[model samples]
Target chain A: MSGCRDWLAHLVLGLGAALFLLPIWLAFCAATLDPAAIDRGELSLVPRLDHLGVFLEVLRHGGPGVGPVWRMLAVSAAMALAIALGKIAISILSAYAVVFFRFPFRRTAFWIIFVTLMLPVEVRIIPTYAVMADLHFIDTFQGLTVPLIASATATLLFRQTFVAIPDELLEAARMDGAGPLRFLWDVVLPVSAANLAALFVILFVYGWNQYLWPLLAATSPRLDTVVIGIVKMIGIDTSTEWNKVMATAVLALVPPVLVVVGLQRWFVKGLTEGEK
Target chain B: MERRTIFPGWRLPLLLVAPQLLLTLVFFYWPAAEGLWQSLTRTDAFGIHTRFVGLANFAALFADPRYRSSVAITLVFCAAVTALSLGSGLVLALAADRELRGRDLYRVLLIWPYAVAPAIAAVLWLLLLNPQIGTIGRWLVALGVHWDYALNGTQALLLVIVASAWKQVSYNFLFVLAGLQSIPRAVIEAARMDGAKGFHRFRTIQLPLLAPTLFFLVIVDLVYAAFDTFGVIQAMTQGGPGRATETLVFKVYQDGVVNLDLGSSAAQSVVLMGGVILLTALQFRFLGRRVAS
Candidate 1:
């Protein structure tokens, strides 16, 4: 009976996995097929491995109204890295400041960052766009990344991690004659390294997956992240390059998927713990 | 909770926090204030003139039939997406929680969908459900089903909901699975000894204990369906087939960005801001003690 139950569990889990993996598998195969065949509604379950050059073809020159895949991927990578690393850097300092030092108005500073969490970019789109325009930051990399780096999530997570560090650690550092900066560099950072990695994966995915912000902020095709580029590729139905769209779609998901999968343990840990 | 041991001088700490403070003030607070101001004021068709009209935009928004429908659409969308995603996530989490072989591999496969961008998820669904080029879509057509989301309003809404929920299930699954694992083993064993088995045991024993996690997920999922699924809706339906899928967030974008209706959009933005704040406050209010413990 237990064996039967195990079999039932496997079957159920397998179906759930396939529900996700099948669409992607079909997309992979569709990406490799000739564009003419796909247009004719002749999608195959099997990929034509020899036609895998479509990935490179799309990478070099994208479909109508879309920039090169390589550039979008680069922009996305840069945005994700900048948002992740920049957020980590600032959040670490700020969290460290709030946790370690007894500064005046420190709670005020923390509350200010916390309040920003309620105002997602979606709610304040127009005014934020206006602000971006006023700064002349529109259609620029700074426009794409910098404003997004001020993350309350990272700050809060780091604060949580820092607060849990025993008071003895701080005393030991003080006893060793190390300054705050040195203690942070040596003790604080090393202790929070795992968290940093986890937050990196989460924020990296967040930055890479941003669509609405980049859609309104960056008008130039050069500033298009992969997510925005794919949307544009499919926007025009007149002479839609189905194969290229599929290839670009695949390209878009690969980096973030790889990051999440490679750091699966930390990503899961951070996601559940940080959010709740 | 205040810390006991601390670094003394305030200057270093203030310096450390200044960058985040500056960015938060300029980007977050300023934009929020601008949205508030814009909501209360109107701009002429020409870009030149602007005047404060005091609640006029809000009054007009409430009076507009389209805005009311958008609100209804948003509520329904949030509800459906939350239910579908959370339901499937629970089932998957439950199935994976058993000591079955290769459970770890099942988890990795199940959770990777979290990484798929909402826009990319839309594109993938299009590849499956596009009437002409889609594999299953073509099959559905051959089976005499009217399967075009592009032209059909109901179909379009369904597609966006599924696509939005698809991208979110992994998040819910991670949380639900964690919640399941966190339940004490002794309790489950006691339930088993009480002769409760399989579906009966889950319904009575596991389900009740999972309430807090479920409550937390509902709020998160509602917020996600409200805001984050913009990419999904924009890519999939563009909230079209005659405004069938246009939730409140999409309406704000369409009015503000495409039509350049700044006042109405700002009003909608303020409304959304209120909704988010309420949702967030409720989450913390209900879940604060749970989180603390």
Candidate 2:
């Protein structure tokens, strides 16, 4: 009975996995088909080999009211990188400060950061946009990344990690006449390397997948990120090149998927270990 | 949570925390405060004169039937996405938790969908269910059933809900699986010895232990469905078939960005902020005890 149950579990999981991938596989197949074939409303589950030129065509010839696919991809890549790096740098420092030091207004500082969670960018778009406009940061990279990175989720994660560090490491560093900075550089950092890697994977994906903020912040066609750019290509009209749109969707999913797959080990380990 | 080790410093810590504090102040606190202030004030469409309207915007929003329906729509959407994502996630997690072969492979297969952007997920679904060329659409037509999300509010809502839930299943599955693994093996052994097995054991033993995780996921999924689903809804339905699928977050965007109704949008923002604050409070109250799931 146990053996049968185990096989049943496998079957269930296998089917679930296939269900999850079906839409994506359909998209990939559609991306490989010509526009006429797609418009015929009879999508071939088996992809045609010669129609692979759609990817190149979408890349080379920009769609209506949008720039080239490469530009949107580039903008997305840049925004993701900048936001990931900027958030990590700032969050690491702040988390380090809270966990490693005794200072005035420390709790207040933490609360302030925590209170930022009260409203996500979606809730406060109007005033946040107004703030961006007031600073002339609208349509700039600073505008695209800065406001959205203000959350405490990451800083809190780092704080938890920092608090878990063995005190002996810090004591030993202090015994070696190390300043706070030195201890942070040599000991704190290396100790938290796994966490930093995991957060990088997460923040990069978070930054890459941002849609609402980017849609609101980055207005210029040249500045459009792939997530926003690709969504715009779906004009809901009959004239939309469904094949090209499908191709763009594939390009958009590549980077974040690669990041997650490559770092899956670190991500899972960090999550379970950190919690336990 | 206090660390016994001490690094005594006022200057360096201040320097260390400055960037985040500055960013938070400028981008978070300042904007939130401005949102509150803006809700009380109305500006003409041309950006001419501004006057403090006190509670007029709030009154108008409360009286607007569209806004009230958006609230109902948000709750329905939230409940559906949460249930669907969590339900599927629990199934996947339970199956993967069993003594099965190729579990590692199954995990990686399921988790990568978490990385797909919500908007991208929506588009993939859009293609899959496209009335013109979607294979599923073709199947529906072959069955003599009309399926057009673009023109049907119910269909549009269903499409958005599926797209939103699809991306979140990865997150829920990861959490649920972790929760399952953390359950002690001896507990399951004890349950087995007591003649509890399979569905009965899952219900009597595993599920009660999984409550904290289930609750945590509910809060997190609700937040995701409410706020982060702006992309999915925007891409899939744009709150359309005539605002039938419009959630509160999308309403904020539509009223604020699309219509440029600054006062009412800010008021809506304030209301949405209240909902989030309430949820965040609930999460914190329950979450701090559970390693935040």
Per-residue accuracy of model 2 over A1-276 as CA lDDT, tens digit each? 889878888887888889788888888888887778788986767887788887887787767657889888888899899888898899989999999998899999999998775467888888999999999998898889888777688788889888889888888888889999888888888988888888888889989999999888878887899888887888646577777888888888889999998999998777655531
Q: For candidate 1, what is the lDDT? A: 0.91
Clashing pairs for predicted structure model 2, backbone only: none
Per-residue alpha-carbon lDDT of model 1 for B1-293, expressed as tens digits? 77788888999999999999999998999999999999999999997899999999999999999999999989989999999999999988988897777978999999899889999999999988889988788999999998888789888888899999998999999999999998999999999999999899999999999988999999999998999999999898999989999999899999999999999999999999999899888887876777577
Count clashes in each candidate, considering only residues at least 3 apart in sequence or on different chains.
0, 0
Runs off by more than 4 Å, candidate 2: A272-276, B291-293
lDDT of 1 by residue, A78-172 (tens): 99999999999999999999999988898899999987765688998999999988999999999999888887878988998999999999999
Docking quality band of candidate 2, CAPRI definitions: medium
Q: Please provide TM-scores, in order, for all candidate models, with all chains considered together.
A: 0.98, 0.97
Most accurate candidate by DockQ: 1
Q: Which ten residues in a row have the lowest lDDT in candidate 1 chain A?
A: A267-276
Clashes of 1: 0
Docking class of 1: high
